[model samples]
Target: MNIEIKVAKKSFNYSGPKNWEETEPWLYAKIFGIGKQLAEKPHALFALPQMIFQIPTNVLQFLFDRNAMRMVGVKDEEAQDEVMGQGYALLKIAQSFANSEAPFSWKVPKVKAAFLGYNYYGPGDSLGMLTFEEFWFAEAAYERNDTNALIAVLYRRDPYRKQTFSEELTEKTLKDLQALPELTKEMIVFNYQGCRLGFSKKFKHVFPKKSVEKDDEQQPKKTKKNSGGWLQVAIGMAGDSSVEFDALRKLNVIVALQMVENKLIKVKQLKRKTK
Candidate 1:
């Protein structure tokens, strides 16, 4: 099955503190680097928990058109068989990207081509506050979820600008964020602890109900087979705050996803007992 995907370019006019460009140019560049990396190897973004998750807009358009063809009986018999196959094909592609850590039986070539086809600009077309928060605090975001880590960096940038949120929920969140310690070099690393704790509190709302499991809340139960086995092996002896540690983390995640795509390792699965 062949499907064409096109994404329109959208600009997010970041209006962060003006001093950031002068004081932390690396952080500024890293934000752009992150977007480029995602475009090149989307499995990196897929491995991490997003603030929001949904079917990519371009993929959804394909699904809708496939269904529309079925209703119209365009090509009649061919459409019936091809449309069914295309649906499965779409699912396989989405699954590979969505379950980034899970083992896969096969690598769908077209899905891979689709992922790499477009240049992504800051989590393009997806509705999430992830890029907003990450771009706002690139350096510290490495070890933390963007949402909670936002306060620490934003506070350092401009405390008064934080008050300009017109959204009621955001306005309320800012009031709560004041409880965190003032941003410092030491606090950059330490603040991640709070960011993690905050995600734990909010996971129920952010992730789907079916995705979360009773035994493990960290990742979806379906993809827990490999767990962090390879990741640990990939980044040994690297300190959390070091540049090497961050690079290895991204590399390993991509490697693991590739291993899954190529069917290199056996994924653990629960055995079914015969009734």
Candidate 2:
């Protein structure tokens, strides 16, 4: 949304984000960085105008001060109050935009001509079509907090067809993604997180929740040894066959997860029978 204010024969126009979908990634970063400061210091509210509008510091100071308003021919108290009210209204709008929660919509917008005249597209709204390899690499990238890598994994040159995963292609695509606008990167991240959330909900059994108990004060806690991570899981699924592993990775994520769940259930059943 755009708002324009005319004061002392000069016009100042500013635009604020209406929602997460419309917000730039850099702006979101700024808002997140200042969130704690905004909470702790009421004076930090003045920073909002600068962030949202890119307003000059001197202009902001002049606009924020009542004495400055008087010097600029806004001597009438009522007029000054009205101008201040507009400023306050703009601040409120900005704050609300920053504070609003993002809706869970796993719809990633397409990036046209990202590289080699190929339009890159994300998995569908629920990521139902994502292959196991794609999901694995994307999840890994997300864990590492590597946005470029995540985007390269999630988006593909073909929208209607599945493509084989290629390290060379992914490397080249990552460079392309880095060159794109920050807003595009932000949107992709937002959609990717939403997709991940949906995937977790859909595969709740695969991601069983573990409750951690607090350690005793007098005794040191015994830490559990780490099991092998995704690499181990992939090896187990492949059963020492490289071809089988490649095929498994190409399987749809939902199907692969179901296979895992079924195997786990069978393992439990066998244990019960033995007992």
Candidate 3:
């Protein structure tokens, strides 16, 4: 199948997977929280029956280690030796449409997927909708053909302008969008991937919530500076010094994903999950 993926080594402002514990509290309380959302939404849908056998701690270590190597000089320095760093792989894609009407799924395969904007046709204008070049929005905007899923809207909002995407091909695709009169084919497609979360070695949380007032001026920045994964480790290390505490977690990743599906969480949910 044609999937237009827009992957970055760092996206949603994190270099890699989210910290686990940040996700634990809600996952533990909500879906797994005894008569919470999950139990209510999914009564008959059986879990895929995969019980935890073992989690290779080594793999976890590999995924969470602070890829501490430093790089500052140009290419060909002795310290520029190729070394295996620590981190996990995250792959994602966005979809775009010519007419902005069709719905598409973001599941890699069979997993339950999250829904995107509803009534998203932004303030009626020449352009029917508007969205930032965020990852989830990109995935939610994906367009499909017989062989490939194409994404091009991000390129529209690019630091570098690559193409105008006005072609017969684009016009044909938007023909399926019943929202407006036929548009000239202006859709271009692209995919992104293979990014590593390796750039936050010397940063710290500059702003804490308590210090900042909750007003327009006091509003936290739209994005964070570090690959929030570190914050996750800090959170996990808070109460317990051992894996026992982690294992004691009542809610799992699946439940969290389900909660997201059920409209139970808000913005904080995406920025606060562990791999």
Candidate 4:
């Protein structure tokens, strides 16, 4: 089945403190470089948690068709499936960019194609997950400057913005985030933490459930079944604030969905053990 992916572009008009063109490009280069280094001979993991974790809006549009999106009283599965189809595709682009082993000098053909495809997912679309939109792009976003420093141009400060993320929540987010390696967590936190911190119930914002189970929560972002594993990098010096867990969880879900669709990960049902 052919899915219609459409995106329209216009020069950003949101007025604030950010000069996105100047700052954002540097951040993007920073993330691609970090993610590129994290990649290995075949698979690598670069540390730019926030950069890639925060899906570029253009890419997201292709993943989710805003024109077809409508929020009813309650979440619906069919609608979710439609959105999920796009969601997975978008996440796949992020992961592929982060996981590919190509050097900084060599851009993968597929990745280049993905960026071109994303440029097409344009102004016609509404951002997926409104809560994240509010936190990352809303008029009063919690974070001022993203890794790209767009926040600096968006506004100087919102005394009201600081009112959103509380002390207790920040502590929890930090502790959980601490558990994740710098290399692995930076990309997750930088791009996702701001949004996830908004909701305490959401698993660091990435796991299916906000309540992290010891068994499931500890699972590495990149799992190795054999000798190969992602290279280690400090997620901290990543230069972006660590994001909430839920956002990371969301990113992971996005990645997992894409892997499944791309046949990178196979789906299987765990049979209930007879008591």
Best prediction by TM-score: 2
lDDT string for model 1 (1-275, tens) is: 12333222221111222111121323323332333356678654432211112235443443336554544444455544555464455445434433332111111111111223421111111112232223223334443655444433333222223333223533444454544333222233232333333333433222212333544555545533333432343344344657866544334222333433233222222222322
Q: Write the per-residue lDDT of candidate 4 for residues 1-275, one digit (tens) a residue.
A: 11233223222222111111222434544664555465363233312322544434544443354443433211455645665565565445546554443221111111111222321110100112222223333323334433222222111123223323343443433333233234332333233332333222232212223233344667645433332111111121122545633443234322332333333112112223332
TM-score attained by model 1: 0.23
Off by over 4 Å in 2: 1-105, 113-118, 217-231
Model 3, which residues run further than 4 Å from truth? 1-40, 50-164, 176-275
User: Which ten contiguous residues of candidate 1 have the minimum total lDDT?
Assistant: 104-113
Ordered by TM-score, highest first, the candidates read: 2, 1, 4, 3
User: Which is the winner by lDDT between candidate 1 and candidate 4?
Assistant: 1
User: How does model 3 fare in lDDT?
Assistant: 0.24
Please identify which of the two predictions, 1 or 3, would achieve the higher TM-score against the true structure: 1
Lowest lDDT 10-residue stretch of candidate 4 = 118-127
Best by lDDT: 2
Candidate 2 positional error at 73, Å: 32
Clashes of each: 0, 0, 18, 45
**Per-residue lDDT of model 3, residues 212-260, tens digit only:** 2355777765544344432243334335655643432222322322333
For model 4 the local lDDT of residue 60 reads 44
- In candidate 2, position 58 carries an lDDT of 59
Displacement of residue 171 (Cα, Å) in model 4 is: 42
User: TM-score of every model?
Assistant: 0.23, 0.57, 0.17, 0.21
